[model samples]
Target: MDEVSKNNVIDFDKEINLLRSRECFNETGFLLLRGIITQEKIKKLRSRLEIIFDGSSRLSASIFDFVAEDNFLSLVSNEKINRVLKQLLGKSLRIYPNLTARKATFSPWHVDDAFSGNKVVNNESNSQFIQVSMFLQDNHYKYGGGIDVIPKSHLEETWQIQEQSLSESLEIFRRVRNKSVNIDSVAGDVVIWDGRLLHRSSPKLTEGGVDKYSLMWTVSSIQSNHKEFLTHLENRGKLKESIENRLYDARYQELTHIKRSDFSNFFLEKIKKLDINLTLKDSS
Candidate 1:
C-alpha cells in the first residue's frame, strides 16, 4: 500500500462528540475500533517482533525497553494514531514509553492509575487522558487472556486495595456479568479507552497458552501536566523485588554480550528503508 493510502486518519472530533452523547463509554469506559490497522502492516510488524523475541535475552524485562526500541516505537507512533492523538490531545502529546506484553496468564481487574502513585481525579464530567492499545495478534475468546472491560466503570468513585490484598482483585472478574468482548483482533486492530476504565485480562483457557502481544500508548492533554516520576516509581514497585533485582543483574550481562554499535547500525538501516524523517540527527 502507498504510504498515503496506509495513513487512515479517523475523525477524532466526531468520534469524541459521539462518545460524549452515548452512555456506552460512561457505562463501560472503553471503546473498540475493529481492524484499525492494515493486514499487511500487521504481518510485517509481527515478523519483526518474532525475531526480536527470539533474540532478546530477557523477554520479560522492563517493558520500557520494548517501547523504546525502534521497531515497536515506529508502529506505536504511526501517522494515523498520531493524527487522532493530535486531535484528541492537541499538539503536545507525550507518549508513556512502556509497552506491556501479558503472556498466557489472566490479569486482575484494575485501573491503570492503580499502579501510579498519583490519585485519580473523581470527575466524570472531565477527561484527563485516554489509553490506546494495538493488538499484534488475535486474542480469541477460546484462546483467552483477552482484555475484559467494565464499561463506564471509570465514572464511579476511585477505590483502593491494600498491597497485601492484591490477590482479591481477581474477584471483580467473577462479577463481570455483562457480555465480555474478546479483542480477537487481527495484527493491526487498535483499541482505545478512557484511562479510568476498569479492565482486566480474561483467563487463557487453552492448555498450551498463547502469547498476547500488544503495545499500549497513553495520550494526555497538554493542560493536565500529569507527573511522570511518581508514575515510574509505582510501576517499579508493582514488579516483585526479586524479579526487579534479577532484571537489573542481567541487564549488564546482556549488553556486554551484544554489540551496541551493531544494533545501532541495524536500526539506522531499517529507518532509512522505512523513509521516516527523524527530527534528531543520529550522531553515529
Candidate 2:
C-alpha cells in the first residue's frame, strides 16, 4: 500500500459531503479514510491497550465495555472524527462512555446493528447509524486476515440467512465468503461503514501472524426512528472508579475544559446491559 504523504492534508468539509452522498454508499457499504490517526498516536494507543490486555482473558469476549484508556479515548473523540460525524449525524449527537473497548478476533459473517435484534435499511435514504473503526496495524488481502464486506449488502431489506437454522446459515456463509472483498488498510486509517452492511473478519492464513487491533465508535443519526436501538446505544456506566476517572479526564480534554462531574453525570445512565464480563481489575 502507498503511504499517505505527510503534506497531503484533507479538506474535511469536502470529504464530509462526499461521504454523505447517496452514490458513495450505494456502490460500497463502507468508506475508508486514510491518515486519520498518526503513527505516533497508534504507537501510544497500542502501548496503553497492551497494558490493559496484559494477562487478561477479556479478549475472548466479543465486546469489552468501558475501556477508559486515555490514548484510545483521545482517538475516539478526535476533532476530525467529530466533524465528519456531525455532518452524518445531527449536532444533537450524544457520545457514549469514552472507554467502551471492543476487541474481536476471527469474526464470522454478521451485521453490527443486527446483533441488537434490529434490521436497518436506508428506506428513507437517511443515515440511520454508522460505525467507525480505527485500525492500529497494517492489514492486507494477499496476506489474509482483514475486514471483508459484500458490497451494497446494506441496501437489502432483510437478510435471508438470518432466519435460517445455524446449519443452514453456515452453509450460506461458506458460499458467500469468496464473494466478499478484504478491506485492506494501513495503521491509523479509520473505516466508517453503515451498520446494516453484511461484513466479517477474514481468517489469518499465516501461521503466528499478529492479531488485528482496532478501536470502534458507533453513532446514530438523531432523526432515526429506532427508539429501542438508540436507547441501547445510550446505555452505559459499569466502569470502575479508576477507569471512569480516566474517561472523564480524556473527555474533558477532548471537549476542552468540560466539567468532569458534569461529563461523568452525562454518561452515567442506567445500565441497560453489560456486553462483556467485567472481571478485570483496574490497572491504573
Candidate 3:
C-alpha cells in the first residue's frame, strides 16, 4: 500500500485489542476512530460527492446508491478496513448498498438489525455484519447532530431489560435514558458499531443549523446468508427509484441511470447551480 493508504488505515490488531481490553468498544458497542482520512482526501471526496449529489438531484433517495463509483468503492476496498472485517467477521465481507452521503440528522432510537437479523454477532462460525460511519465534519454541542447509543444495548440481556415504548417523544426517551452516550465526532472520524446496538441521532437541540456531512457503509460476512440482506437493500434502492419518479422530473433520472439517456445538459445545469451556491456562501 502507498504511504497515504498506510497512514489512513489504523493498525487493526493494536486498536482492536486496546478497544476490547478497555471495554471502550465492547461496553459502548461503538468505536470512534479519529483521522481515518487526511484533510486532502476529505476535501477531494467531498468535492466528488457534491457532484454526485447535485447532478443526481439530492432529493432522489437513490442519489446515495452509487456503490459502483470509484470514490465509494475506494472506501470499501480500503486495505485496513478489509483486514479489520476479515478479523471480526470472516474472510469474505460483502458491502451492502445505499451507502449514505448526506447531512446527518436526528432519528428515532432503534437497532439496524431489528429489521434484518444480525448475522455477524449471533453466528458462531461465520462472518458478521458491522457498520462504519465516516463523519466528514465536526458534530458537537450546539450543532445538534451526532449519535446517541445505549451502552451494551447490543446484548440480548439488555434487550430483555427494556419494555420502553419506541414511540415516546424524544424528550421522554432522553430523560429516561440510561448510560447512553452522545457520540460527538470530528471530520474524518470513523465510527464502527455493531448492527444490533440501539442508537439514535442526537436531537437537534438548537435553531442554528449546521451541516453534518457523513458517509456510511454496511458490510457483512459473505457466509452470513448475505444474499437475503442484499435483496432487502436492492428492494430499498428500487423504492428510491419509485419515489424519485413520483416527485421529480423524468429528465433527472438520466443523470444517475446514465444508460437510460443522455443527461449531460441537466447534470451540467444542476452542478453549475451548486457551484454558484457554494461560491456565494464562501464569499459571504
| Span of 10 residues, lowest total lDDT, candidate 3 | 275-284
Candidate 1: tens digits of C-alpha lDDT, residues 103-182: 23355666765322245443544455677877766666566534666654667645343232454674554555463454
lDDT of 2 by residue, 1-284 (tens): 22222222233424445444434654455666665766788787667666666775554211232333445545555667655565556554544322334334556677754332444434436456777777777775544434667766667544544324557657757766656766666777776777777776655666555556777666655455444443333332222223534223222123222223332222222111211111111201
Per-model lDDT: 0.50, 0.51, 0.52
lDDT (tens digit, per residue) of candidate 3 on 1-284: 00111222343334544324224444445666654567888887767666656645443224324434556545655555555555555565555433556554455676664232443246222225677877776666676445666656666332321223555535545644766667766666676777767777766677776455667767765555555555544444455467734334222233223321222344324323322111110121
TM-score for each model: 0.65, 0.66, 0.65
TM-score of 3: 0.65
Clashing pairs in 2: 66-99, 67-99
Clashes of each: 7, 2, 1
Rank by TM-score (best first): 2, 1, 3
With candidate 3 superimposed using the best TM-score fit, by how many Å does residue 162's alpha carbon deviate from the native? 16
Off by over 4 Å in 1: 1-27, 55-68, 100-105, 114-125, 161-167, 228-284
Alpha-carbon shift of residue 127 in model 2 (angstroms): 2.6
Model 3 accuracy (lDDT, Cα): 0.52
